[model samples]
Target: MDQLETMTCSRCGGSGHFSYNQIHGTRCYGCNGTGKKYTKRGAAAAKFLSDLRSIPAEQFKVGDLILYQGISHSKFVRITSVEVSRAKDQGCYSGDGEYQQVKIQCEGGYGAYYRPGNLVRKGCGAEMKSEQLRQALAFQATLTKNGTPRKRAT
Candidate 1:
């Protein structure tokens, strides 16, 4: 039986050839110019992609507008996302990442991110009486388009 073999590198034009110079003499190899190797993607890559999609909108503030689309009375939210976070310190490397629920605030009050679509939810905004919410949305949209100044994120 016979087996097949593949080229080690395609960078050198399949010659498998490379050159080097030493204090004593010069040398050449048939494999590589530097004898280094390439590696594949790691677990970090997958985590990064997942994080990108799950952006923490809760970081936004009171006058911010978020992309919201559902059966709710309104198609968008005028208030900012609210996130409750707690710090956890083990010993050496202290870090904070975990989160719970996000809520949107309006002149009337606060509500769950998903409760706006809930039938039993009761609130001025929930009842579709969102004059303030509507104004906030419109103002924020125009401000965003005109590049109006906003508070810097802390």
Candidate 2:
């Protein structure tokens, strides 16, 4: 296998082959029996998927450093308390995203009731590579294999 393009199968120890072979073993589940290796894209997708599922700093526990928006860049603040309550989205797109209110109090004698879905963790945005898996998933659902966006019904 070409290292620059694809990886060698590790699951079957590169023994599995696309064609019949007497000495080598059959392909394993890692690469669908064709090869036991994961493509570069597959590895990248795994990384992005993990980033997508992981909680924001494990739900921002007390004493956790947070970078709040509506504040200066990277001006970290410590979390003092966290609570949840019923609240509407406080933005122009008031009807979108999570509606449950998340109240966070900082140790600096200040508090902010950030709008749900407005609190974006670092590397968690449309333009971020950390969201590449999500972008791929969304695109697969909304686009065709030939690189054309699918059309919706009228």
Candidate 3:
């Protein structure tokens, strides 16, 4: 899991400035009038890290907490199976349905997992390295080299 590089300020908890001199009704310039510096990793970055860990189905199991990509929040889900079901239209923005579909139960809330390719589709400002796909394919080689599990968390 990736740790937040910076934390919210303790004094004002990242309000970015503080209102001081109450009698004069003035703000504090020392703290930038909002009292806290923005964290290096803000809410969006935090959410992105959380989403990375919540990539869903690390290991297929029953009643595991499942998460679908392109959805809002850490929506918990109960899983039934993790095996590939059939080749279905993934509705990918890349217009490529090359990947196989792994069917899952909704278990109440939204249960749609967006294809990773959609990250490029939305112009999300993230680019995968050319070697990333190759490394993913050669997982055993990566594990041998790193000798550490590539753990992701939400």
Candidate 4:
């Protein structure tokens, strides 16, 4: 991994804190309150490293967790097979009857068929603020060329 360059947090002016008014101040979300932020190249390298571990969506199997894109605080859904016996037991497949009916459970425990596009694997390095994506990137900066992490100089 290339070195992640640091910059003074513009939102907080290197203070690690931002204030909307004299009475209100909060830690800078931009830099995670470290007063330093990553350069564009650094961020891209981190993202590229993450993108390397992802596999094609079509390869997902039973019990795999998927994160649906284009939604906020999206919960991970595990794939489970649901058998449909009759026409009334059918799931939502928004296509013509020319193809065989496929059945699968979806959000809210309803039966639905998923196209499996834009779904990210749970282990993928795609950023999730709640999941410490940046923290992992920061840790990556401390690793040696051999892929082992080195201690800070203190």
Winner by TM-score = 4
Residues 40-144 of candidate 2 have per-residue lDDT tens digits of 544544444545544443266677656665644444577889777766555744556437766878776756665456533432334664346555555444544
Per-residue lDDT tens digits for candidate 3, residues 54-154, read 43343345566554445345544666555554455547534465665545555664455433322211101225422332333344332322234445556
Per-residue error at 103 for model 2, in Å?
Answer: 0.6
Residue 153, model 4: Cα distance from true site in angstroms: 32
| Candidate 4 overall lDDT versus native | 0.54
Clashing pairs in 1: 16-30
Estimate TM-scores for all models: 0.24, 0.34, 0.35, 0.42
After superposing candidate 3 on the true structure, give the runs of residues whose Cα lies further than 4 Å from its correct spot.
Answer: 1-13, 16-58, 68-72, 88-98, 113-154
> How much does each candidate deviate from the true structure in C-alpha RMSD?
22.1, 16.6, 13.9, 10.3
> In candidate 1, residue 52 scores what lDDT?
31
List model 4 lDDT by residue over 1-154, tens digit each.
3355556888888888875544445767777678997665455546544554444454556665555443345555666653332243234544453333334544556345434442344443345532455555666566654335576689
Model 3, position 118: C-alpha lDDT score:
28
Screening candidate 3 with a backbone cut-off below 3 angstroms (N, C-alpha, C), the clashing residue pairs are 16-34, 16-35, 17-33, 17-34, 17-35, 18-33, 18-34, 18-35, 53-153
Consecutive 10-residue window with the lowest summed lDDT within model 1 = 37-46
lDDT string, candidate 1, 39-134, tens digits: 112122222323332335455556654445445554344564454543344353434543233465543344445322222212233334344334
| 10 residues in a row with least lDDT, candidate 2 | 117-126
How many residue pairs clash per model? Answer: 1, 0, 9, 0
Superior candidate under TM-score, 1 versus 2: 2
Q: Give the TM-score of candidate 2.
A: 0.34
